[model samples]
Target: MKEKIKKNKERGIITMEKQRLRKNKGITLIALVITIIVLLILAGVSIAMLTGNNGILSQAQNAKKRTDIASEKEAVSLAYTTAYAKNNGEGKVTYSQMQDALDDNGTNAEASGNIIVYFPDSERYYTVKDGVVEGPFEEKPETELSAVEMFENGQNCDKQDGTCTNETHLHIGDYVNYEEPTSGEPCVIGPSQTGVENYQVYSLENNDLNWRVLGIEEENGEKRLKLVADSPVKRTGVRETEEGETITEGVGPYFDIYGAEGYLYAPDAMDAISQIFKNDDAYEARSMNINDINQALGKTTDEQIKEKNFLTMQGFIQYKESYGPFEGQWTPEDWLKQNRPTSIVSGEVSAYAYLIDNGSLPSELSGIATTVENERLRSMLFDNVEPETGKAYWLASRGVYALSGDSYASFGSGVVTSEDGITVAGVGDYAFNSNGYEFGRSGYAAVRPVVILNSDVLIEKIEDQPDSWQ
Candidate 1:
């Protein structure tokens, strides 16, 4: 058994039993080490591949950028195509023209810039500049213009920019820009430079009245519009009765329905400008004057005048009510009541009554330049000149009457204007007849109308529209 164990002796002497040489196991160990080294190298290479600039995260980001840019470019191209198709036959879009359309619903801007941008909504936008379809802007501007804002952007236009113009040759009935609703009397609504089809015309009850621009005024740092009748209204009445009387039907201290305040109470101007209000049979007839429209300006009701937003009643009457040209004293209301039928002396003239001669509520009323005491009705004249012809028109001041000691308050009377530069009033004086009846009237004169406008309403002139000659 001992002889069985063999060992391979190298060059040494051989033993009885050769020891088998132990084959070196070092080779296998070496092979294992080599394999571990190779595995380590592979791990290092994998980490580098995941974290490099051209790795997965980077590729994903690039894909997103490409998608977004393509989407934007497509949208910008679409906008231009659509605009051009509807561009009213203009071959190419100019930067200014495009901007004008974007800035305003109406456009006429013509410039040389190549960029045209439109910000549709807070989050939607596009820019067209330098002939490049730059973006469908991911972010929008902070402030935006309103629907009406663009319409009101021009200053007093001395020249036509397709929006506002200086309007050097405004006719009597020419439409002017009124940045607010108007009050006072309305102009006759009809075919004109500003078409009735374009803007809504204000109406009283049912019928239309003439409403026109008078002038622009400043109030609380904002502009206000002044309006008046384009022409003298046709009506009739006399200047005096059988004898000279201060206490009269046609005059104020208004015991009769013909008083200034009474214009709305009843259709006192029946012969002058009274029409039927179908809804109310009891008050079937009403006066379609400035006072009536003024009273109905802001009511919650759904009447025609209220819907128009045409104007606002003027409330500033600073000057003391007095007679124009002549200096005298004639008290109103209580004092006149205390005095009785003969209380008003023949010589005493009221400045308030004299206001009838006012053609317009002036920066200081021009034309007859008379004064009025009516808190309701404002007298207006065409400044002695015809609205279209520049010819002088007539006006009214104090009405003449006769004191017949008629307790029925029935006396003959008529309105009259002071003889001077010009006068504005109803052509005929509204007076009482000999029968002591209110209609006991006579004579014919022109009716000049006046009105006031509310702030913030725009009255833009239409381009290419010509003035309607009177």
Candidate 2:
């Protein structure tokens, strides 16, 4: 309602007015929004309680707890029954003798809450812990098992209850090749089946194996280990020597404990590896072959680099000082006549001396001969056995003589036969009578190829062992 006042005359009647003020009521828009949000929050909390990871409804639907307990109980009953049956229906049955019967293979049934009762006589039992099925954790495995049981002699890994034993590192003196156990066949337990491919190679650094490639040169008409594809470690090849003898030689997991080389050689990739076999290089230390060549010292500063330039991953190498090639092992004229040994780098000792001092002695000669004569480094260098492959593997030391001729200046000094006969069977009597060489080339042999990892090559083991060289 409004009250109005009327004017008496034209001047006073112009301004009579009515004014009213109303009370604001009900909830504001903001308050209404807040109420709706509160309701949604409560609804979500209730829903989550009904269906989240630990919700009562979720647990009820799992069905695992019930089924696991039942399965486990059944396994236990089976073990008990089997043990009782063995008692011949007459003697008192005890679970003690059933230990082996209920080991990992018998007890794991993907169950839970079912308790295990290991009879005192039971030496082994299975257990399902942390959702993993494991058993026979109680005792050591018997060693008398057959090769098949041990994942050998063509046993499939999936066929065994236990996994194929993971392959371990092969040590120096192992003579394994792809076709060792039987000719043209992969060894029973080498690169063929074992997943372990790369082997650690080294030289006697600080009396331990240090890394060095003998020298880039052709042997058996094949290249040495290189960064290119088809690693020598995986190749199935035969070592044909100068004396017309063929022997077991091919690329397989080899260890050069002195060189710090690692190979990722495996059976499947044997024929198709990525690393190329360029040639052998024997210098312990040298300037990059890319540098100038030194004739007097027989340094292949230029030629050696061109040959080893195939290096890929290990390219992180830097320049080092030149050392060795004491001299006159092979004549420079000999290399020129045959047309090879384009690059000659030297080492601290002749290949012969290195073999005598560092090579792993053959099992037969371990106690009999401490050092084979220099000329006999080839004939006397015997193969070592690889327990896994059950065969002898070749060493990098090819049975060749280091030429000793003071006459050819630097090239002849310490030159070893590149491919055959410890002496020059082809080069005439001038090789043995005048040159003083030994051993007719007899056979091909496995080479423990090596490469030095850059000092920066980071590895977990290297980091863990700070005193590694020590």
Candidate 3:
């Protein structure tokens, strides 16, 4: 019986050892399979990234190529336009002509393919090969000649007879105006204000005239006409105070010279003016105020100016003034008044007093008008003023002051102005003062050197929001 028990124990031990070995082998196999699967996934990802057309690397390359092409095309177009202008409305230029001009202007002019130049007026396009001008071919249907047009053989109509044998006369684009009578109207021909300034008149015989037309003129040309039909007169006012002295006071002869129409939002304009003061480097001016504001006229103001915490309008008025019988130009009376108030309570009175005093007031207030006639002042205010006839002005607050709800302390709301002082427009967003505790929310981000008024009240105003008071 002892021998049988010992044999049974030995068998049990051997079986247990075999089972442990089998379990270890199964785990090893499973782990190897998992590792192989992970490796396969990584390989697939790598292949796709390397070969895919829209991969990250390919997209970046394509974007760079597109930008390079656009820049090259612009450079080529500018070169052509400059060459055309230099030649006085005569002589057709081929691509070689343009390429030589560009090279002279320090630009690369190596022709990559067959270079063609199109003239819209003659409807002629000339090709350049081996530095020689070739056939003036008819424009291809698929080719877009936006800046000019080209015609070959003048097949559409007879140039000498001024008549179209085919439907060319009736089918010609809307370039002809039958309403503009040729008699006594003095065929007002030259440059069509916007584009190429070549205009020639052909007497339409038998209802046909082969007039070559070029599209609109180039926008930024040095030799473009600067003729203005009418300009608005800027006026100044002289009011005698109780102390007895002639003082220039009152609003404007606000003119819409550049066809500036619609309501002028005083507060919004003031905010823009403030930004002009803050970014004198961008505007190439010194400060904010009417003068600096004027220098930046015709250009869009900075987007940061709209943050109503920086500027506002004070009042609207009809301004009128005269210098002398010989020198005074008739002035308009409607003016949108503005003020940067230390406090809303006394801001209006202070601004009015400053304007009325005209540099004769106490030292505190006299700083406002010391440099009214300076070149910097005129450049800042008069040069860039874009006032429409029927626009509104707004009142804004500056410095450390608390504003009402939805009203920003720095730049306030815009309001409408009629002939009479009427607040027709609603207050702008964030167009109120901010509380003192919220200085961080109300103050400007940086100190900008700005002209605060027409006088010498130019100073650096702090623009930042603080977390807590000292």
Error of 3 at 386 (Å): 57
Among all candidates shown, the one with the greatest TM-score: 1
Candidate 3 residue-wise lDDT, 1-470, digit = tens: 88888888888888888888988998999888887887887777767775679765787788875575455555556666665676553333334447566677766544211355444434444544333444445663233221122211222433322233332222112122211112321111122210112221111121111111111112222111110001111222333444866455322332111000012222222333223221111211121222222222211233212211112223221111111121111111111113322322212210110121122345553333223333322222222222234222222322112222222222222222222321122222232222211111111111112211111011121121121110
Rank by lDDT (best first): 1, 3, 2
What lDDT does candidate 1 reach at residue 312? 12
| TM-score for candidate 1, residues paired by index | 0.28
Candidate 1, superposed: residue stretches over 4 Å from native: 1-173, 176-210, 217-222, 232-451, 462-470
| Residue range 230-256, candidate 2, lDDT tens digits | 112322334444485755542433321
Q: Which candidate do you rate higher for TM-score, 1 or 2? A: 1
- lDDT digits (tens) for residues 369-441 of candidate 1: 3343232223222233432233222222222232223222111122323335434322123333222233421
What's each prediction's TM-score? 0.28, 0.21, 0.20
Q: Best by lDDT, which number?
A: 1
Q: What do the candidate models score in CA lDDT, each in turn?
A: 0.32, 0.27, 0.29
**Compared to the true structure, candidate 2 yields what TM-score?**
0.21
User: lDDT score, residue 210, model 1?
Assistant: 44
The lowest-lDDT stretch of 10 consecutive residues in candidate 1 is 310-319
Candidate 3 local distance difference test against the native: 0.29
